[model samples]
Target: MAASEKQVVVVGVDESDYGVHALEWTIDHLFAPSMPDYPFKLIVVHARPSAASTAGLVGPGAAEVFPIVDADLKRSAARLVQKAKDLCASKSVHDVTIEVVEGDARNVLCDAVQKHNASILVVGSHGYGAIKRAVLGSVSDYCAHHAHCTVMIVKKPKAKH
Candidate 1:
């Protein structure tokens, strides 16, 4: 199939192990070279929190602090994207595209699906409890409901004790 004719699969990733595991699982399952023809294009997306949002502060030397915080956020985003790229490379999935969008993960991922006309959106579950999920707002849950395409929430298997 031509490049543009391939279906797009967008995976949201973070620094968490769950996110890494999801990407790995997606690669192993969906992008396996053994498949006759690769019909899916992989897009790895990282949602970066803006420095102002992360800082959650204003006034009183906030101006001086903003630039420093922004720089740190940029570095963190670079590291996260690099890690995702390295993982894809290690899996022999080099045709993947990586994006760093500054916003909430849920919105960024949903927008990515629309922007890329994705057929599937995959995200890792943090496995938070109900109360925690309520407080923190689950990105996978939100994407599952709001994204136009199919959504897959990859959960890390519980470790054997």
Candidate 2:
């Protein structure tokens, strides 16, 4: 890959408390120093299930409720993206884009990185250990293990004592 070509920097955009911080740190720590001849781009992905049609539903059916919930999730995703972008702009970062993906966050982010041939996958670590992660599951660990590209696991800034 040439230095002038732009590589995709995909990040999860959701209400997760650390998502915004991950976005900010990525722009500052990764892209700013490594921006090639081309400007960097960010894809903010929010995943959810696709809507199911309820036109044929009667008194109570999954159809009526499913679409509304999915719609709400997309809206939330949009908000996260906006907040991230706004933060970036406030800090003078550019070349950012937001997107919503309807699926599992881990699967969606991984797929996107592959599809975009991403150079690095930036994710936040909620500090789940191996045993706990095995049961509860951690997106950061999943991406680090499954992503075809390099993965950057970001932990929350250590709290002040």
Candidate 3:
């Protein structure tokens, strides 16, 4: 890999424990000391529900119902991004970028993969049960099938009793 061919890995992130676990796993498994050097860069992507979705949730006139909720959402997204950056920094992974966009999570992640020309798209599993998955769907599941690049779904390590 040359200067123009930096290796980029895009990972979906959120405030969830699984999200943090995915980021940590990527650093440990992909960028560990034993890996070959290629100017690796990690891109953290988070997707917030669209403003329309928020508006709908608040009610018909909710678009103007509460500006505070919109503001709060933005702040929350920023905080999550910052936390992810800090985690990367602590792990000695400095070449990191944060992307917080409002849209469907699956689309946001897929778009990031194409925009970054990422060779791998990493996401964490929430381990939703059959009922929940049928109702709410899974981000990792969508990404695995739709991402332009290779997809890695990181699962939380199970604890031993």
Candidate 4:
């Protein structure tokens, strides 16, 4: 594929409302335009769980949480991507390419951008402070600075008072 015409989009997914917002942005701004005309390829990614999580599930009702019995992070990631695709398809946005990539959100996204020759990278911002985010550099911040293509960070809506 020529570097000139190469185009693709990557989204970071998690349980956060921010991720959902990013999904919506991708649908409306990117995917919606190509729907039913020619299928657009979208890469939906989810961060993997930490190694310590394997020690055992946390909180009450852990066993019944996922409720799938053998549900794993990889499986959950795949499911979330499919769920996004299904959402788009229901609205006639068919032919989305889904993949569940594991690892750090920023790295995974950057890697995907390079791998698929993506022209844009989208992520959701938690709107945390520098000190707070310093301990955890925001994925949006990271991709915006490092990605090969344009980066769009979806800011989470303020909560209702």
Candidate 5:
């Protein structure tokens, strides 16, 4: 089947283990080789925060710091994409696209869904408390309401003491 004919499944990932676990869950449950002729195309997306947004500072030395911070962010993004690719490869999922988009996670993910014409948008929940989620503005929550497709928020299981 042509690429365009396949239903797109966009998975939003980050450096967090929660995001990684979500990807794993999506693969294991939806993209398993055991499934007969899975017609969905997998696209892994990483939203990379810009240096200025992450630096959280504006001062005399800010200009000088931007380059270094930007480089670090680029490296981090590369690693994140590689990790996602590696995970997919380990699962025998070779026909996958990995993207690193520079923006807030919520916006990037939603845009990716539109750009890819995705049928499903998968995100990992941080499982924050009400106060923390309110303060930080949960990306999963935002995407769940704003994304144009079905959104799946995967929550990682907590470890037992």
Candidate 6:
């Protein structure tokens, strides 16, 4: 691809409502009527957490159980990416590409941006408390600063009290 031929808009997705919101926001705001002038590919990315995390949680004898857990995780990730693809198709955004990668969410997403030659990366914020965010490290926060492309962090709607 040429230096001026940047294509593909990469969106980080998952099974959460926040992920859905990010996809919807992309369709509603960026690709709604479709821009012929700025035609681009839509690459929906979902980062599956490493199986080691679960293996560690299940204790020492986890080797026997890790395969089952890993399989389930793969199935769940496939379902999530498929749902995101279907949602985009329903919004008239067909020809979407789905990528299910494994690793830390931040690294996976940033890597996707570079791999896809995307100019923009969209992700949703989970709105965790400050302490939780500090401890866990927000994916959106990491992507905003680390991604090679421009980043859009969508916020999920607040529930009515």
Residues 29-110, model 4: lDDT tens digits: 7666545454346777776664334435677777665444335665766677777777677666665666665567788888
- Per-model lDDT: 0.92, 0.73, 0.86, 0.73, 0.93, 0.86
TM-score of each: 0.95, 0.79, 0.88, 0.75, 0.95, 0.89
Cα lDDT of candidate 1 equals: 0.92
Tens-place lDDT per residue, model 5, 1-161, is 57558899999999999999999999998988887567888999999999999998788999999889999999999998889989998998888999998999999999999999999999999999999999999999999999999999999999999
Against the hidden true structure, what lDDT does model 4 obtain? Answer: 0.73
Which of candidates 1 and 2 reaches a greater lDDT?
Answer: 1
When summed lDDT is taken over every stretch of 10 residues in candidate 6, the lowest stretch is 32-41
lDDT (Cα, tens digit) per residue for candidate 2, span 1-161: 66777778887655766776777787777656444433556766665545552133445676667777667766776777678878777766666766777777789999989878887888877777789989979888788889998888877787899
- lDDT at 16 for candidate 5? 96
10 residues in a row with least lDDT, candidate 3: 50-59
* Per-model C-alpha RMSD: 1.7, 4.2, 2.2, 5.0, 1.8, 2.3
Which regions of candidate 2 are displaced past 4 Å?
33-39, 49-60, 129-132
Candidate numbers sorted by TM-score from highest down: 5, 1, 6, 3, 2, 4
lDDT tens string, model 3, 88-110?
A: 87877777888888899999999
- Tens digits of per-residue lDDT, candidate 1, 83-153, equal 98898888788888999999999899999999999999999999999999999989999999999999999
Error of 4 at 49 (Å): 3.4
Which 10 consecutive positions of candidate 1 have the poorest summed lDDT? 31-40
Candidate number achieving the greatest TM-score relative to the actual structure: 5
For this target, which candidate reaches the highest lDDT against the unseen true structure?
5
Q: Which regions of candidate 5 deviate over 4 angstroms?
A: 1-4
Distance from true position, residue 113, model 5, in Å? 0.6
